[model samples]
Target: MSTDVAIIGLGIHPFGRTPDRTGLQQCAIAVSDALKEANVAWNAVDFAFGGSTDAGNADTLVSELGLTGIPFMNVANGCATGGSALAAACNTIRSGAGKLGLVCGFDKHARGAFKVNPKEWGLGNWYGEEGFALTTQFFAMKIQRYMHDYGITEVALARVAEKAFRNGALNPNAWRKTPISIDEILTSQMVNDPLRKYMFCSPSEGAVALLVCPASDAEKYTKTPIFVASCLMRTRRFGTLEVFSPSKAIEDQKTVTQDASKVAYEEAGIGPGDIDVAQIQDTESGAEIMHMAENGLCEDGEQEHMLARGETDLNGRLPINTDGGCIANGEPIGASGLRQVHELCLQLRGTAGNRQVKASPKTGYAQVYGAPGVSGVTILNS
Candidate 1:
């Protein structure tokens, strides 16, 4: 069965370290704001889908809100947690299970790089024992290879980070509002080879929530409803290479973002050329450059020219991460993908205040990639 879902409401709390608040507390604020914006009541929500890495039992949120006895499932898909949960909620409505539902994600990360057990992703103990499990190392290695193969300069990487911080300065919800120049980024403390401290996104705290219903009923909630044209999620193919993998793919390799984007465009009946704005995985500056190609927004090696020509800026041909992506807002695990959804929704509705893209774009795309080679893509139209 096929049905259109409308995102009538979206809410995101300020993204940064919130030492005073609990994960549930942050979620409560986001959900409350979303319900108010959607003009929806807690009891009216049929179900909820969401999860958090550091925060426990997402379903326990019912205690903070009302115990309406709705089905709330906990979803854990690493960094793509929010996208996966939103997909489940959309599927629930499309399958005739319910009309109105909630999709929420929140996370409170500790200081330092995100550390995980190697056994979780089928890695051997040597990874955990020898300290080869850090995600930054993987990002560095992958981008280093990409730059070498594509002849991308170190300045190109710095350019992406500079743009991210510049955009972040305009977003009140962003964690790092102070803008930095390409020179600053290039000279920042080196975390991994070719990646500086400013280039990497920190594990921060944030929460985001969306209220969705069938498109037919969206008018009842909001005048400018953002329709979810397509939502697709995919895991790694056999030859795909990603963070946490020990070996690299030699041939016939396609990244999960590429395959999932193909499905998203097919389902939406649109191509990359149709997208006016986008938000992709930017775990670091290089990730954005690589994802631009992987998501089919541009061909390989085109990013060098795009960055130089200001083609990806707010007033350029296609604006990305207009509301300060992971690079500025910081990655909140479960909430990261939903944050992208919120930013795109604002753009499609022409409500992205200071960072609003020109030309009044009618379509927007969002993609999120996580560890162990998982990707989720969503297309939104006004």
Candidate 2:
């Protein structure tokens, strides 16, 4: 039986490079802060789920939080790690496995572009050596095709990046805190055909944790507990094009994000128009532009117009990625999805400070798309 869930507490570590700290330390800070805010002891948490990459097993956090012998599961699903963890926790709770649970995501990787080992995914070693599996190339090719079909321009892409950096300047946890102009982004070095260096999100380190329980009991913890209207995940179908797909077949197949979002909106009894704010995957400016349409936030060819009119700015019709997004916060893989949720939690709670959307946002939406074709979406209300 599905159950109603409420987020009683949320915690996040500043997103950026930190050479001096270990993944465990960062996760500990986030978890401790979450527990303290929830007013729930670590031992009181009935179950736990976490994700990580290059940071070893997530349950290793037991060393820092003390061994409580709870059923802590580890998850790793490329960039959807955190979202998968949340799905597990929420399902476990809904199935009556537990009422109170903890979900954590953390990662720390070396400075540089992420390397794809095709052999790990069953491809030949030559695929890796020749850079045929590079994600940057996939983004460039996809965006080029999108622009060709939808009339999107390089300026539109630059505008998205410009907005991201400008929003990042208001986010204390953002990695790239300085804002840049559209001209600066256009003139930046090109990493691929159409994707410039400034247009892409950098890989970095960070951690985020959430405390969830039945909404009936949320008032015991906080008066402003955010309710989880829906949380869902989806994988690509046969005709879907993805970051590491073998083909870019343009067929009648719908994207995983589109499907997941449709289910989420239905379950929540709401539509995109009902959402007041959002935090979508912006691994690059192009991804953000495409996702705006894919997630049903707008029409296919409306991004160019919406972006040009500042319709997506902080004070615009629908403020999005108000906390800098991946472009400014950096992508920490396992930690990224939860970071989006954390930012929305702050916005709904009216505690987002400098980056808060005006006019009092009552509903929020978040979506995360990952490599090899996977997507996760969540809807929340205050």
Q: Which candidate number has the best lDDT?
A: 1
lDDT of each residue in 205-258, candidate 2, tens digit only: 999999988888899888789888889888888777788766666675888889
Full-model lDDT, candidate 2: 0.89
Best by TM-score: 1
What TM-score does model 2 achieve against the real structure?
0.98
TM-score for every candidate vs. truth?
0.98, 0.98
Candidate 2 backbone collisions, by pair: none
RMSD of each: 1.2, 1.3
Q: For residues 248-295, what per-residue lDDT tens digits would candidate 1 score against the true structure? A: 768858899999999999999989999999999999999999999999
Off by over 4 Å in 2: 1-3
Question: What ranges in model 1 sit over 4 Å off?
Answer: 1-3
Residues forming the 10-long window of minimal summed lDDT in candidate 2? 243-252
lDDT of every predicted structure (CA atoms)? 0.92, 0.89
